[model samples]
Target chain A: MSAMSDDDRRAWAYLAAVAEPPCAPLIALAARYGAVETARMIKARKLPAGNAAVLTATQARCETDSASTDLETAHRRGARLVTPEDDEWPGWALLALDQASTSVRGGGPLALWVRGPANLGDASAVAVGLVGSRAATSYGTHVAGRLASGLADQGASVVSGGAYGIDGAAHRGALATGGRTMAVLACGIDRDYPSGHARLLEEIGDHGLVVSEYPPGTTAAKHRFLTRNRLVAALSAALVVVEAGRRSGAANTAAWARNLGRPLGAVPGPITSAMSVGCHQMIADGQAALVIDAPSVLALVEASGHDNFVRSPATPIDGLPPDQFEVIEALPAHGGLRVEEIAFSAGKPVAAVLTALAVLEVKGLVDGSSGVWRLAESW
Target chain B: MSAMSDDDRRAWAYLAAVAEPPCAPLIALAARYGAVETARMIKARKLPAGNAAVLTATQARCETDSASTDLETAHRRGARLVTPEDDEWPGWALLALDQASTSVRGGGPLALWVRGPANLGDASAVAVGLVGSRAATSYGTHVAGRLASGLADQGASVVSGGAYGIDGAAHRGALATGGRTMAVLACGIDRDYPSGHARLLEEIGDHGLVVSEYPPGTTAAKHRFLTRNRLVAALSAALVVVEAGRRSGAANTAAWARNLGRPLGAVPGPITSAMSVGCHQMIADGQAALVIDAPSVLALVEASGHDNFVRSPATPIDGLPPDQFEVIEALPAHGGLRVEEIAFSAGKPVAAVLTALAVLEVKGLVDGSSGVWRLAESW
Candidate 1:
């Protein structure tokens, strides 16, 4: 947990306090000369090769604010700074983000300020993000809550932003199910942005985790939500957009998920509802798979995983009706058999054979013709 | 208009009277020996090279009933025999079926017994089939009706069976809109099997067409409905399954549409609705596109047409907000520019530029980063 030296932790905290996450120049310089040296150089008014505007701004802010005081404030709130170098850092997701094309300057967070009992590494290993519109319909909320609960019950951590509608429902669903749920905030973990979900966020911090890139006391800005979306996408094995308007923060997270090659699943709502338009559009464009419920979501996760999951058809010969299976056996592969022939071969009445054949045809087990039937090619 | 001679027409009419539509043996024999010659052979109790069981049964029935009498009955019922040799055969669809592998012996109808003022060729040239479950929910019927109405309004003929639920709704919608609609019946066009839809079927004959493969007085058998689905799929430019239970007849039509390589679409409903499971499964299997409304359905039809239709993005330069368009124009192709740089180039306030960039990002026209933005690759 104390892999970072005292000076190194302070330097990382100082940069995090003054600068926004994914500061490209700071990240690059930190990679090259380490966070302690990068911090000193920025404070000394040194310039990078390109885009020093962000660095200059951070340095100006550093002149007025105390980085040590910011770190102490975060600690008082029971939050700990987790940099890439920290032993407790969820490196798998964040490290993968380094190779992704992100909306922010750095591919992902320079460091995560987290407060919770849940282990970042273990919880994140099987995370499924549940995000959607703040103005989600009751249908959307119900669907989100159920999916989140199912995902949590399946031992996958449910990650989401601490917004009002879908996000709040998802977190509450997980907690209600007695499962772990994490909230990734746009503002400081200590300051709940919606102002209404303070209790919910507090409970998340107590039972699961509340994570942020910004230090304590930082306010959530409009752009910060968009910037923080990449984190949500990056931290999960898969991202499920429960319901989103055509243009919403949820769409942005979807874009990030796609750009990162994460498996994207969208819960389909009624097409008549404007809330589900983005989802339908995504499915139409082949950007997301239509996921109706929790089982489908898990199926998508399994199929998209490195193992190459293949689903076995629900109907097998043993599962078919006895008469239908007998009829299927009576038919030929290359051509077909008349119902009378099938009846005689299966030792069934002609009318009974016809009925069985009809049911089998509907089940896609056989094809029926003019009093003739055959095994379907799919069989 | 009279391509078939009197003898040839009578022979084709005789075959349509006793044999089912898509009787493969009859189709093959007719193709080999012409309708008159095929009829003569059947009358002599002769057989084809393969699968003569259907033809033998039809010939045995023909021994007692006269072919001329059957034609007289159909003619009295206001139904004319339209064969492949005739000018009004509507052969484009059935000819395409000649290339398809179907469940019945023949790939498609050898002759269509049609009763209506509408010309089959002209009416069917731009047809769109809207079919679904007979036991549909109100939601399914509503969507089917609206989509059918929209399709008819766009100068495309709406096609469906004269059954209850979604099919009836589709036909009624087209007729209510004062647009062309044709019902492809599983039973004889003269005998509306549902009885409840008799008036609706009669009205369709008045305005559009009531078409069938069977001659007058044939009943709608369960297998006939399944066999009838291929006609619905083959005769349309595209087929949309509005709402279908997992094993409904609409799913069979969807399967036929896919097998025939026709563009297929399915309307998305509430996921909780069991009726939508078949439609959703089709979408998940990549057998159909998710179409929300009639416009989207038409859009798919256009996109899937022979011209290889490419959609023009909804938002062009003129369609975008001036500031957003300017910000997009200010972005670099190779890399990205900071918000300040974009603001300077676009001659707008930094805050205004940021706001515009956010909108543009949502529009998927531009990519915004940590204070930097660029044109999205998709744009």
Candidate 2:
């Protein structure tokens, strides 16, 4: 696709800098009249039905035409503007957001300010959000890390906030596994908000992607965190909450995941851990399914070959007696077959086939329900 | 009701000794022909339709005419035979068992052999089953103990197998809280199977109940434990599996609980704990709800006053200013009232009532959903 026209890119950059993310009216206006026209109308103070105070403030912020300067600085910082028109834009999840209303009234970003080596589209296609308490316990951090590593090992990207505790652990775990990870930041990708995580963020940008909706010079603000949650929820196929208190920012992300009809899972922890209360509550309320491991999370996400990750491929048939091994071989993967059919297919007597199937079932290499036998789930 | 006739008691004693528990055909025969007639036919080999091998074995076991001797010995051991016809029989739960098919094809004891101070009916009336792996970790044991103690503190009885690990801890925890507990033994109630738990079992018999189906001298057999699980599931309004492996006996009890439509809960431990695999599986499979505390368990069981147990009664409204206190006092407990209705009742302006409600909500004393306000769940 052709590169975005300079005017459109400048319009989006100006919007990203001045308008708060998920400003529904601004999103609607920009979509109705292309960003360039919308920016023009707002600048001339001729846009109808605009919030006067917000419009006035936005015009003052954009008077200097900082969009060009911001764009230049972003390029200097190795960051790029990902507009909706870009072929490399992560569109499917954002389209999903556009079609659904968010719990926090959040919607798709007009443009993503990204800094990273990974392609936005591919990075988001297989992303699974791993989020939880900033004040997570060791148990929560350990579980989050394991889940992230496991998902990454299976070639899926782990997506999370680039904050402390569980989020930081998840990113580190994925990186440690030599797998891709992305951090969707509440602040500008160019500026690490936590300061302590500057090196960590730098490593992520080098190895994976760092995404934001805010301009490069923007600092992390309170409402920005809540608004940023929608991006985290939308970018992933599923969101796994490692640990959260009853009322938490992570829970808001969970709500967005639900609003967008994404599969949401919560890892269970000891009932005594207050950190796990949100997860337990979600499970109890039927809002989230309980997930214990990476494979289970993958299974809920309906990722291809989840069952392959669920367990080691069935124990080698070579370990079994020749008869049992032959019987297992006769069992179809797609559907079960009856004893006589299996026997006929395996060139064995019905009685021998029955005995062999029994042994295989006991070994959990095969399963028989009703009168038919099939390869077990692990197999 | 009049006491059970001596002949009926002796007949039940004979059946208990000769037939394994949950022998559905045997139970059906006894129920159809009465225990006295069934015992007579089995002894004389006149029961023509009986399973030939089972009947033959039963006849051999009864050839010594051990019923009277067993009854005498049981009495000497301070135990009593509780026939189905006896008023002291725990019939309600067994009736529920009769209605539901069990996973292990288990049924209620034809006659429970009991040695305890607590009444069978009362003890089983409000019982909650707390069970898990015998190879429980300290985490499992600690959680089990807490759940048991919490349930007992609220006047609910805990029922569990009288085994080491989780079960023993549950019973001990209940006792420590001066709450009633019942130990449903796999072996004869007269002989504590583990031997190490003898003193503990004795304490249970003194303070709660020790019940079994086998005759006084019968050793605990492998099959008996599986059969005994049904009773534990049936007796409880709900079953909480604190921790279990993928295929432990506790899973069997969980199946029975499902078959019986009992509300089943699992207290989650760290996902890394192998002991919690079965619970996580159940929760992930939607077979069990995740519960974090006793009140959560009770809420799942549909027990009355569970919300009350969740937190102390709301702080007195008097602590608030007269206006806000009046608004809080106006909100009904059963269902929420509208703002105008609340205002009129509180003798305050509608705006002032709304302000008070908002403050109370932030204070965690009230809740408003839609347009109506009510006392918060925790309050």
Candidate 3:
């Protein structure tokens, strides 16, 4: 529907042949010498290094053989060559890519075939990747939905690898909240790898975008999922693992997230649930924060200066004076003590303690039961 | 059976009126004035200041009613005044008694009704008090029994209030293993408040010892349970909560132990069970160490110099060379990689890898499943 560039089309075509990751490596090499030049060098040198990339391009051509009628056809696909260093390329996502086994050489990102209006890796736009096991339990689905919807309600975009269970739940949560979410697939944009999530995948493309490192017509494999996780990790400042078993793929993603020093959040679950094991280990080892709610997750990320998200708990207490805390401090951990006892300890006059207690009661800072006082439910 | 003293008889008569804990304040006060003179000064003063020795004598008397006879009567009973400064007195126990209350005096124990061949408060002997829910599940009972037996096996004396559930389980564990134990009661030594366990209580008194702060004929009251917790906390260098629910009474004992600066151990359990909630909360807040086995509990106490108990691996590797470590390092978090891979990474030959794997596997450092390897346990 739009005018496309010839060089971009040629780059896209070249990417079609690459079947391997360190796709970044090939792309970087291509960027340095141009795809045609690099391809020529590879074949001439009979280098195994470029074999993966060349094979991928060849496969894409095979799958879309009749689709690209001629060389001119490549120029009309509306695609472009966006390398890791491109000004348009997200600097944030490099956090994910950086963790991968980069090309033994200096190359990274063969070439990224990102197609979306929203910058996939924009730091200003809050993006969080919600990931977990594909064989997720209902609890996992519930948590993923709740956390994603919460992030979206705060105007943050959600990202995930269009898979089953957690990934789908995250996308649906954002969509249901009337927010945008992107799906970074392991296969080509034109090919939904799972095939079962086709409808949801298409819906995401319609509302947000579906991105892939592979060019058009490429299929996905198990290895692709691991590679896919990196994109999910790199695209967001914080990666929250909603649910993951001990050996779940989500653990790998979490490992990558942690290695990048990114803020990681994991929800706590019953200790007996296998899905909760990885999260427990993560929280136990101090690799993740135990986030139980949306506000909490947002607060953790914002506190990290990860995405610059902000929260203003709109209420009288948000602007309350320090003196007001006297009421809360007086509340006992073992329910409540007598008013006189609280007043005596607070070092305030009986009338003053009563009046402040009343005011805090109205403001929800204190819950007065009979003559005793306890902390209000704002916590 | 032994000589009698008029002072011992009168001490017992006076003890008949006061309860265990208040006895601490009384004896501490009595000892302050030198003999009963100082104790009377403290008892007469009540809430006000008195001789410092009242602190010691009161705590000792509170520990156990003064045998209702003269010094000769106490001597006949094979018991004598064990003061705070007594060389046989446990220094670690004094640490707990010091914090009986906040804003109000809390820790002082008037006196202890102790009768044992071993100095009841000997610092050299390790004592761990195991307390938990009166209604323990099988899991709690199993863990308590194993932990108690393990401690007993290490020649550590077990101390408990001798209540039901965890306490009863611990005593049984020690008895089954033929190890020593002490029962500190809230009622008179001659009276068993829980009639259901009267015979068991008697057996313990005969086999080990039974102590109470109340004098002869004093009955156990609800308030006495709280006073009883202090004794449990004070007698041991560390207190381990085997099973505790939200707001469980065991938490109170743990809090007391903590306030005394004694190490606390809490066994982790399935979070879904209400019984494990308090323990989880304790471990979560760093108030207690997460102990799954006897070694962990012993490790913590020993580190604090309570007991020098350590458990070496069944098959010790001892100063292994690099070649052996190579196989150990290559295992998965919970599984083993192939010996070839391990050896390859270690820069050794396949034969060396197999030999190392076999040796380590037999020693429990590595486990060979299929052709892969993993650590025996996650610790």
- The global C-alpha lDDT for each of the candidates, from Candidate 1 onward, is 0.78, 0.80, 0.63
Error of 2 at B97 (Å): 2.9
Score candidate 1 by lDDT. 0.78
TM-score of each: 0.77, 0.77, 0.58
Model 3, A96-127: lDDT tens digits are 34323442311234556654455555622577
Candidate 2 residue lDDT tens string, B50-112 = 357448547557665678988898888777888767777766566546545333565567788
Which model, 1 or 3, shows the larger DockQ? 1
User: Candidates sorted by DockQ, descending order?
Assistant: 2, 1, 3
- Alpha-carbon deviation at B359 in model 3, angstroms: 51
Instruction: Residues A1-379, candidate 1: write the lDDT tens digits.
Output: 6766878988888878767666754665565567897788777777555537656657557565466876788789888888867767775666446545334443667788899989887788788889999999999888889988998899888999989999999999898898999899988887977889989999999999999998888899988888889888878778899888989889999988877667888877777789999888899889899888778888877876522111123245543544566577667767888877776655456888889987888888787754457778885
Give the number of the best model, judged by lDDT.
2
**lDDT per residue, candidate 2, A47-147, as tens digits?**
76645644754665656567998899889988899987687788665755754534355667878888888998888877899999999999999999999
What are the per-model DockQ values?
A: 0.46, 0.58, 0.07
Question: For candidate 1 chain A, which ten residues in a row score worst on lDDT?
Answer: A306-315
lDDT of 1 by residue, B67-164 (tens): 68767877887778888777777766664465453444337787888888889888887888899999999888888888888888988889998889
DockQ-superior candidate, 2 or 3? 2
